[model samples]
Target: MLWIPIDRSLDIPLIRQVYQQIRERILNGDLQSEEKLPSTRELAFELKVSRNVILEAYDQLIAEGFLVTRRGSGTFVAKGTFLEKRVVPNHALNWRENKTDAANIIDFRSGLPALDLFPRKTWAKLSHAIWNDTSHSMFGYDLPEGRPELRQALARYLLKTRGVACHPEQIVITSGATQALTLVSRLLLSPNDTVIMEDPITNDIQTIFKTTGATIFPIPVDEYGIKTALLPENKKPKLIFITPSHQFPLGGTLPIQRRIQLIQYSRKTNCYLVEDDYDSEFRYEGPPVSSLQGLEPECVLYVGSFSKILSPALRIGYLVLPLQLIEESRRLKWFSDLHTPSVEQLILARFIDEGYLERHITRMKKVYKKRRDYLMHCIKTTFSNEVQVFGYSTGLHLIVEVTNFHFSKEKLKQIEQCGVKVYQVEEHTIEKDKHQNQLILGYGHLNQEEIKEGIARLHVALYK
Candidate 1:
């Protein structure tokens, strides 16, 4: 007789209990391969349960290849079903616990927008309207190139705002800018191919290209962006990654002279330039600079996302491809999740077409500029002549260069221990020890009070 226990107290179904125990026994090798079991009637009689419950459990086991029955014979365990359990480490649990403990830290992490200001009511209304009026075809598999409505809207908006010259067919909507970069990497790179990138670029971007097994050639940037004069003359790179409108971390708008030089270099080497226009929408100085793609559309691939302007939760980003790369890009995008969520794309299209996106940006720009100005004032007042600020004219974040301070790992941990978290510019540098005195401070997500308190905490951490 088989030994099976039952508990009527558990909220779990009796069938599930029976099924799990039998499955566990089989996998644990307690039940030998091809061993026969008591008939359903016999087991039901033994367990004092309904015959139908036993039958259902047996049926489930049979369906899962755990058990089989011969004609005119009893059921038997399937062969090769036993598996040795392996221990998994608790690192993930530990990480989650640590993350929970960081809730009180005043984090100055960059690349985040004012999430509290997201138009939730407007978005909800759009979502409801979309769900009500959407055609049946929209719920099914969509074109990998994304909805025509969204692409057309993007074309008009990008032309008017960023001076990017591209048709709707050339835009490929992606999950986010990260995916867009991945697609670009896959499209242009092969193992051992060379890529030229900014020295102090975002670490995530560097990691993405490195995953392609390509070597990244780092060109150092000054206050005016990449030293185009220092671009490698010996090697022909596959692609050149840059953030021209507002260079990340360092925040230099690539000067026109260097922009032309970069275009000339790409033309000479027949390499494409990947322009990441991340947070140019919130420029605090003059009007936003035109994208590098506008100068030479065929030689540049422009990547943009709504993460900085709206919310990263949207996960809506796009790549403006050259004419020659559109077909293959569409194929690659098709293979990558078979297009982004169709309903969200439709909603965003309506958002852009109705002028909601522009109005939101205009509103947020003022809010961010105020935060930026207040942060600058706080830093100057607190640090006096001890620190210098860089890249304050544009973007949601700026860099503060402290006189003779190196943000080593131990010092960073100490700062965090003081209820403050700040990012070091050295963490993003390709060549180490170059940007040790600099730190990136982001103000987009924090209100004025949080900003002031964060600056205060940072001051205590840095000086104390």
Candidate 2:
């Protein structure tokens, strides 16, 4: 092990500092894969730090994928992870140099939880109780289909809350909705099968769709969700994916009549509808929009996640599948990590069983409703008639159409620097320049203070 300097005066602990250094080294290729690392005691003594500090650092490294420990064989650097650190002279970071700088600025990004307001105390109590009850059985490998109790609880939640029809047997748990989409794309889609998607949705999903080698057809979206009128008649696509429950970014709920039409089309076309119910819980105008999965279960693959409502880190989500697709999805899930963690599922089971989740959703609904109202009020008070916000009734975000102002990328960068952030509608489009005057503002995570101040700064950026 190399000697690492310990900074006693820094607020960060020596263990964390050492961990970061080693991780950076391993990621950079200073340390090769499967190479033996120095023992904790030896490294501690050599670096003149306590042995416990070294052990703690190693523990964290192991928890992440930085290092692996073998019983009686000592720890070694992780393989296939040296890219994070190695520098190529001419290479430049292309993803986003502004990620760091952007993070430092106040954010208005969508699909985020209001972490400051979640009921941690109540969740802790349920978690502790679940641990006491199932710590023994949870130590073994779990069912690939996920924890039975959580599935059962989710079944009840769907019936009462979302009007979805399904039993626990048809429900499969995965890491999150992203994983759900990945496996669905793999299982249902053949190499050249066609996928019909909303033209202006999150680019993150595009990665998964493209990797499947599937032919993607981008259908146009309007204020009433995906325009059924614009759906391609010639392609006969294999599957159609939509965010019907308060369409992402644009925030329009697919109306019930349109949902029925989509369902009818799915049945007639023999195609599956991947309904991503991402943020339907926080609608400020009224009760949550009814899911398309309710219209037709066989044609609709309903997906939901607790990321926005509870926390993203939970990494727990459910998919309601038709019986025809259930076995294939289970097999895909088995190959994809076998199953999700049982302890968290067990805790969530108890959480829902005892009505904790319902309570949490009710509480969050009020919190987000208030935030949504404040967002509307802020737009009305600050920008007034200058900016027109779309789909303001439901979901976490609203689409602001800047009337007569040039909403250029350079202007957006300036607005980002001015301490407010938003999604460029143009980026979501397959073709550019269509949504030049539009911006998607997410207000779920921020409180009254951040929302007000962020919008005020945004106004300064806009008017200037």
Q: Which candidate is the best by TM-score?
A: 1
Give one digit per residue, the lDDT tens place, for model 2 in 1-464.
57677789999989889999998888878888999999998999899888999999999999998899999999998878777535656556555455536555768887788888777898888788877776586889888889989999999988888889998999999999999889888878878888999888888887788788888888878888898877766777889989987877687778777777787777778899999998787777778877788778888898888898889999998888999989989999999999999888988888888888888888888888788888889988999899898877776778888888767878888888787777778778765678889888887888898899988988998887
TM-score of each: 0.93, 0.80
lDDT of 2 at 248: 70
Show model 2 residue runs off by greater than 4 Å: 1-104
Clashing pairs in 2: 27-85, 28-85, 28-86
Lowest lDDT sum, 10 consecutive residues, model 2, at 91-100
Model 2, residue 315: distance off in Å is: 0.5
Q: After superposition, how far is residue 127 of candidate 1 from its true place, in Å?
A: 1.9
